[model samples]
Target: MSLGTRPAANAAERADNGAMVLPGRSHLRAQRAVKIGSLAFLILALSAATLLLGRYTVTIPDFFHIVAGADIPGASFIVMENRIPRVLIGILVGGAFGAAGAVFQTMLRNPLASPDIIGISYGASASAVFAIAFLGASGLALSGFAMAGALAVALAIYVISRRGSVAGYRLILVGIGFSAVLQAVVSFLLTRTDINVATDALAWLNGSLNSSNWDRVTVLSMALAVLAPAVVVLSRPLRGLELGDDAAAGLGVNVERSRLALIVTGVLLAAVATAAAGPVAFIAFLSGPIARRLLGGYRPLGTAALVGMVIVLAGDFAGANLIPGVSLPVGVITGVLGAPFLLWLLATANRSGQGG
Candidate 1:
């Protein structure tokens, strides 16, 4: 028999001998299942910790009772009114950032290409800051401004990066440069604003959950509810696009249209997140890479979202309780967490001669 026929006969013999699982495919499937299961468990555990551990901490029994519509003294309001909204918002914003970050990184084919890093977050922040400082806008109005700002910035990057078509490397470079400009605008606005306005703006810029409420939560939820599914629907096209525009086009994907759709969707996700939580630091930039590492480079949006949830919820809890007599913002904690990782990645990339 030929070599391929011999291998096929051996496999057939192995199967006849009661080896039910195919070695390579089954092993990969099992590994993925285990990874996904572990991620789900971690997210659930972290969520429980988020709900149970706080200043007005709720016991297991009372927490269940509160969920069951029981009127417990002091517990009901704290759980339902404050903690619930906070936790829910954390999940939504984190998921949105995570998914958006993954999409951006995948679309651009660069690990460093993320919303916060490439100027999308700054666009949202700058616009919202402008509204807060000058237009005296708050809440939903600020969210609108953020959305508009992000879209504008994304479009500008696309336009600038295009010679005949959008090039991933050029897009990233332009985005980084534009990000600097947006940051400067934010800084300039801060300096020119009144002290009180600037104080609120600074808190927003730092990305706090201090003002998380049902209204903001609902708004973000609706936005994600629309945008996330769209991202998923476009995921196949996105995967195709990753193989290069020419390959994607050959695969029956409209490369330009798909790219544009992805950019809009990603920007919208980032915008809503910034609107809700003031662009909580590094959740976007960190989630995709973390998930990629955990899942062996196959980017799953759900996994990325869960990673983001854990990061934000856990980070928020640590920021609130870990420090003595001081509560830092969630963004501060994430910034701290991500900075070291970024440096390490940079060093590693440099060592490998991958950083151009």
Candidate 2:
């Protein structure tokens, strides 16, 4: 009787333990679901706000009407050529910057490691500016020249940094140094150019959505459609990297290879974004931290992208309305917002002894 009683008691306890684990698992899953929902909602709200709150007010009904029928005269041109494409470009460029920044910071385990910090944006900016200022390239031609210049610089950085395989910290440091040089080069280029060319180049460097059209949208959409899948496929390896290099290696991850792949992807993302939007200022640097805060300790890549989209669209909208007479550059607004945040981050990193 006693033996039978012991077996029954053990069985009941085991069942209770299993039941407890189920709730724990359920809690984690629910948390993730909420996070996803919140991020999705935020992006949707910002996108809708972009379409609705512009100077040329188009309500939800009109927006849908334009979408449904292309024959609607002014509505068709306004929807297809203006608001729709501008918003699309905003989302693409913002998401690319945010995602690239997140990937760099997470991979390096350094919050300061982003595409702009790495000189990738400067590379693209320099090329784009030189082409416009000196070569007199404009329109579609300038974009191609810009892309080419950006890629060339990225390749140079990769080659220079790969001393016995590029370490994350080393690559970042090298990139910053390289970017400093590029900035000087940019300054010299602008100084040498004629006033008109210089003025035009400055505007391009500053960035704006005023020039966004269907063509810009088409180019960026293609890049995102391709890169988004690559990022998703690599998410597992990226997550594993957070567990420290040795642990990730123990789990059969090729740490160095993964790091290189991610860096290349990040460079491409930043390069493409810079070419399109002239490296819209704080979206890359601010997005990761903001997303992390919103998602409550989860490193939020998708959420960060959403936040970037919101930031760009909102900043551009505010720029349109802020001064009335002059259309402020999107980069100018983002710079003002991000500069303070960057200062705060530097201070925090120092306090934490993160060795940025």
Candidate 3:
């Protein structure tokens, strides 16, 4: 009788503990849901503002009418040709950068492992500049060169860092070195080009959305449609990978294969986005950390994507309208915003003894 009662009491205690724990878990889930919803709402609000509150002031009714195919002349041309493409490309590019950055940071277990910091963006920039100055490449051809550059740099970094396994710090150090060299190459190319060509290349290097078009929108949309799903599928293995290679292998993950896939996917994501937007300055670096903070240190890729979209849209809006008579490039605005954040991150890392 005593033994039976003791077993029953143990079961009751276990149930009570579970019941006590569940509420906290439920509360955290609820909070994350709220944060995600808030981010979605913010994106919508920004999109609406970008569309409706520009130089021409598109009314809500006119906006709906334009969407419904009611051709309103000036409004239609501006909305359809300029504003809509810019918003669409910004969202797609930002989401791609954010997802890529989160994957790198999470997979490598290092905040400094963003594509931009590690020479991938510089690689694309250098290639695009070379294409412009020497190959006379433009449009899709320029984009292709940029993509090839990012992939090549990523492969080189991986190969150099892969001694036994790629350590995050070693890869980051190698990438930084590559970035310096590529940056110098870009500078040399710009100096050697004709003044007119240099002017055009400089504009692109600054990452403006003034030339956003439907073609860019279509290409980026298609790329993301394919890559986003792949990222989603690989995210499970990515989470396992965060637990270290041996541990992930213990859990039946093909550590090397999974890591390779992730690197390629992340590189491609950053590549496509750079191809579309000229490496829009720090969207990749900033999105992951921002999302992690918002979600209480839990890194959800979707949330990071949303955060990236917000950053780009907001930056573009500010750049276009902030100085009244002068329009700044989106990259300029983002760089200004990101520089302080970068400094803060480095300082915090140093204080925490993670600076190395």
TM-score of 3: 0.97
How would you encode candidate 1's per-residue C-alpha lDDT over 274-298 as one tens digit per residue? 8898989999899999999987888
Query: Clashes in candidate 1: how many?
Result: 0
Query: Over the full model, what C-alpha lDDT does candidate 3 score relative to the true structure?
Result: 0.92
Full-model lDDT, candidate 2: 0.81
Model 2, range 163-195, lDDT digits (tens) per residue? Answer: 876667787788889889999999999999999
**The best candidate in terms of lDDT:** 3
Lowest lDDT 10-mer window, candidate 3? 347-356
What TM-score does candidate 1 get on C-alpha atoms?
A: 0.93
Clashes of each: 0, 0, 0
Q: Compared with the true structure, what per-residue lDDT tens digits does model 3 show for residues 234-277?
A: 88898788888888889999987888899999999999999998
